[model samples]
Target: MQGAVGELRTLSEGDVAAAWALEAAGYPPEEAASLAKLQYRQREAGELFLGHFVDDQLIGFVCGTRSLEDHLTEESMDVHEPTGTTICIHSVCVDGGLYQKVLQNSSKTNSDRTHSSKWALCETEGCGDPVDGQ
Candidate 1:
């Protein structure tokens, strides 16, 4: 949260670079997903790719693909199954500094609202079944 509350929305092709940047910065180099992978997610599973924006700047995101697998696995991470019913969330990244600020604010309300809405969208998409976070 900055001057205003952040809003969550579907990420599109245009948001890929920003999303990749946040991913790289939020996770260690070894754990970060490659730009190509992010690009693939944007192109193939755009519905599951969500960005948290404040003043139109991408600060965080949650991305994944639809899967029939019971849990997160190599295949789920690499492929998008449009007909699948389970969501395999690949990343949940937030800008480092902003994340700290939210913790300091000590209010779960904002974070909860964001996650709730995200899951709500997943449910609507018919892929709300939780798989282990990857």
Candidate 2:
């Protein structure tokens, strides 16, 4: 059967099963998050978690936290000051058949190796269209 178009949504407690299912399908068994961690992130403030669903079933996710730590700065800070947002894509996976399509559509262009977390923002703003499948 042909897979349906994927939809994006903020992950919620109700989606634990679907999320775990996707994790099982996408990664090795040892890597999947326990249900408790999933629930905690959903309730945590300033945490951003997004999932891709096909016909109401979770198929992929991009979860991250905003931190004040500068990835490029090695110097220790005396006092922590929140700076620009850091969006870490914990994972991005799709069914085997759709891997190429997902990669083509989801990758970010002009990605700075110094700041990997900015890719999510770049992809969202369409800043790097070269990698996106038009």
Candidate 3:
């Protein structure tokens, strides 16, 4: 894990290339959002897009939207209200070789926090794995 941390800032037009690269490395073309769509989301405040880079190269990303709904689906796309209800961890992807590193980093970041109210949701083999603890 030899890398520097970049600020997890809001997405911007300048980040489209990096974002597209991250998505291409993780998902199929049809499943990933276009750079324009991502930029639009950032402009509209419709989603939270965070990027993780190493040596100025994008290697991972986490994106989600705040919503009152518990889980996200296609239907949820129509609802853009930000209620701060749930910080849904919609998409989290790391370069194929860096999954473990990303997971460890995430666990470390959340480990110190008490497990009383947080619900962590992750996907494994296309199944939602919800864990309620630190």
Best by lDDT: 1
Q: lDDT of each model, Cα atoms only?
A: 0.67, 0.47, 0.53
Per-residue lDDT tens digits of candidate 2, residues 23-57?
56766666655656555555652134566677776
Model with the higher lDDT, candidate 2 or 3:
3
Worst 10 residues of 3 by lDDT: 111-120
Off by over 4 Å in 3: 1-10, 45-47, 77-79, 103-134
Record all residue pairs in model 3 with backbone atoms less than 3 Å apart, i.e. clashing.
Answer: none
Question: Which of the two candidates, 1 or 2, achieves a greater lDDT against the reference?
Answer: 1
The number of the candidate with the highest TM-score is 1
Instruction: In model 2, state the lDDT of residue 97.
Output: 57
- Candidates by lDDT, descending order: 1, 3, 2
Per-residue error for 9 in candidate 1, Å, reads: 0.7
- Per-residue lDDT tens digits for candidate 3, residues 36-117, read 6566555554335555666666677665544455554343333444553444454567774676665555544433421222
* Per-model C-alpha RMSD: 7.6, 8.7, 4.4
TM-score of 3: 0.63
Cα deviation of 8 in candidate 2 (Å)?
1.5
* Clash number by candidate, in order: 0, 0, 0
